[model samples]
Target: MQLFEHNPIKIYNSLSGKKETFTPIETGYVGMYVCGPTVYSNVHLGNVRTFMSFDMVFRYLKHLGYKVRYVRNITDAGHLENDADAGEDKITKKARLEQIEPMEVVQRYTVDFHNILNTFNFLPPSIEPTATGHIIEQIELISTIIENGFGYEVNGSVYFDVHKFNETHEYGKLSKRKLEDLIHNTRELDGQSDKRNPQDFALWKRAEPQHIMRWPSPWSDGFPGWHLECTAMSTKYLGEQFDIHGGGMDLKFPHHECEIAQNEAAKGKSPVNYWMHANMLELNGQRMSKSTGNTVNPDELLSGNNDFFSKAYAPSVIRFFIAQSSYRSVLDLTNDGLLASEKGFYRLMDAVNLLEKLEVSKASTININAWRQSCYDAMNDDFNSPILIANLFEAAKYINQIKEGKETISAEDLATLTNTMNIFVFDVLGLENVVKNDSGTDKLTGAVNVLIKLRQEARANKDFALSDKIRDELAEAGILLKDGKDGTTYSVN
Candidate 1:
């Protein structure tokens, strides 16, 4: 049976702006598409937060026994500066500044993005399509839109006729903006634009003479628009109507709205069944932006080189911090918050370790089944990770109570508790133990044993200073030594 059979999952659909029960298009499978990063620069922490949110979603769906085909596209081309569908292509601009090929810029940052996400232990997507690779599909889509009378070409550029599309279908339905309001709020470009209306975004932009990312198209030697890539790649991989489409909340207005218009105008159907948008991440109380000197990258946070963090934090701790809040809530990255999450992470993992050493009793004081159900209930309600974490901490407290003989569990209940923790913490939450294992090799084990013996001798001889030095120094080197009733043991932290 499916894990979600008894506990139905509910998700907040951004399209409807309400929580709805999740039902996949297929019974035993799911298709999810999320917008990947535009590889113009190193990904910021806000981008990481958005990807991490979807990573959690992907993990939980697989844990529920669903075969999920996840597609996250790489924007190697088509994305523009300031997302205005104007200005230079971001990759082309970066290539010009660096005096390198546009592909070089894409390759460098794509590798960096993969490495950083790998360090954070994110699962690889099933299909990672690139925008450049799907230019033909995008061109075909634009031709269909033009044939349908919703697109027009002017001066070698193709623009989606937002006004015409709105007459047939709602153009801003995803963003809940009226067409009149959008026209009123649209800002005029400085130079003369070929677009009929300020809201009519580009389907294909005519490449400027200096633009390095040009490709041959029906209109001109140009590139696809920023909004066209997701629509093209997603439909190719996940089909016409998929289960979910997701991106950051900032993309809702014109980017996603244009995508909706393009897809409907071309295919006469909505492309996605559910729309999910992750909320923004802030630094201290302000939005993270490089221009304002308020942004911190993942490398800076992990290395503790940025002014925002007090000390270096492990990747697992960072993942745990993100998991402590609901994906829909605005998360503030602060030193104090990270420190607290660090403490909580260790506490939960320590209890998990202690579970193995716990002795089974004749009767159980706490109902493990009830507690397990509560954990599932929390996750079922829109992936409410904060509440799930609260339940996990409660289980941790119970583990401690059992260790202290204040509570007891049967052999069956003990097994259930152990398995539940392992599944939720490691599998569903995508969190690994921050501490490393030092017991794989006899040589390392012997070295640790020698240090433990030397420390024991120092304590026995009343050499308190030497003993303190040995323990503190080892702790600095990621080896934590714990003194217990039996003897001294150590773990790599």
Candidate 2:
């Protein structure tokens, strides 16, 4: 909760197109609404990466002692099948293939999404409002947009008047796209039977004869449009205006841009103070998306069973990997990167363990202030997590050296180290010792293996005394050992 002297806490605001100091709307409180997954299929690694990034922001705000009302919506309905309004509902398509009801598909994937996020140790949002849960609210929002003359109802379908919204407010403000460019590249579809412009999107889509999800609204029996849900849900939960609105960078173009227009049309003001976007996760330098045929499921990442991964990676390792990069930058996934991150991740957790066991000295030899300052300085610069992590690794190296009697720390500095790490690493960044279930047994096994390797290296280097000493030290650590044909075998006694 302590804001350090070096703390700046700058955030990249998409609205302003600049990194700005993150001051909350309400004093000491943050109202954040992030667009959740559509839940029409298992969440891809790309989606997981975005959520993890937001989790860091959410966790960090809470760590700052800010009262955060984080609202993430489950798009059980309202989201379109594609960016265009022409495609079928993704959930309905999934239901057809799975031979189940659309709601059944929603429930299954929604549960799956939660399971994967929980495995990653992400805290649940303050409120998770489903679009299906707020049909009336969405209907009311569409009505307001229509009443404001920014939308029109055609037959049973209601579409937002984008050409009209652009007259008063910059429609492409969020995406930095020009209206003329959109009109030029825009593919004219058949759905615009009554739309005022080709660039306009739906607020409510009239249900087709075979449509699975439908609700009776003032306009007609239909479902809400994809962007309408967020506009409705955020206003309903976080009020008409909120602190931050975030989602994947891909959503910035049409989805978020449309949401901005819808909110402004209904409320006469922008819904969010700041627009935050986390970049996509790429595989082999290509975006990992369903359309790209390179999507990696969270289950694959957790089990490490995907063709892209050699071994299973823990959820914390995944979180750390994403956090090591700026939220606004695309994160490339590589086998070597994960391997390097695995080592870095364990090294970090190892430092946390060392801090808990360190015996504080009366006087310090290490400069703890410099380390603390560097951490704050990095985090303050637009949540530069990679720099913060590098600083943390430096502290870890110092902690390890101190543990080995090669360095020293004062009692006060030791307490600072403990608290600093607990705040930034665990609380703010939201990394957990996910290996705790196997930590006790795993630690002993790992130590024994390391000692055996060291002893073999010593023997190879013709250091008999060092090899003997290594074996003796491990024995004291409750690991009895026997010389083996292969090398040495160890067992905990």
TM-score of each: 0.94, 0.88
* CA deviation > 4 Å runs, candidate 1: 82-87, 437-444, 450-479, 485-487
Tens-digit lDDT track of model 1 for 301-355: 9999989889999898999999999899999999999999999999898888878
User: Per the 3 Å backbone cut-off, how many clashing residue pairs does candidate 2 have?
Assistant: 1
Task: Give lDDT per model, in order.
Answer: 0.89, 0.83
TM-score of model number 2: 0.88
TM-score, candidate number 1: 0.94
Candidate 2 lDDT score relative to the true structure: 0.83
Q: What's the true lDDT of residue 191 in model 2?
A: 50
Name the lDDT value of residue 111 in candidate 2.
94
lDDT of 1 at 33: 95
Q: Count the backbone clashes (under 3 Å) in each candidate.
A: 0, 1
Best by lDDT: 1
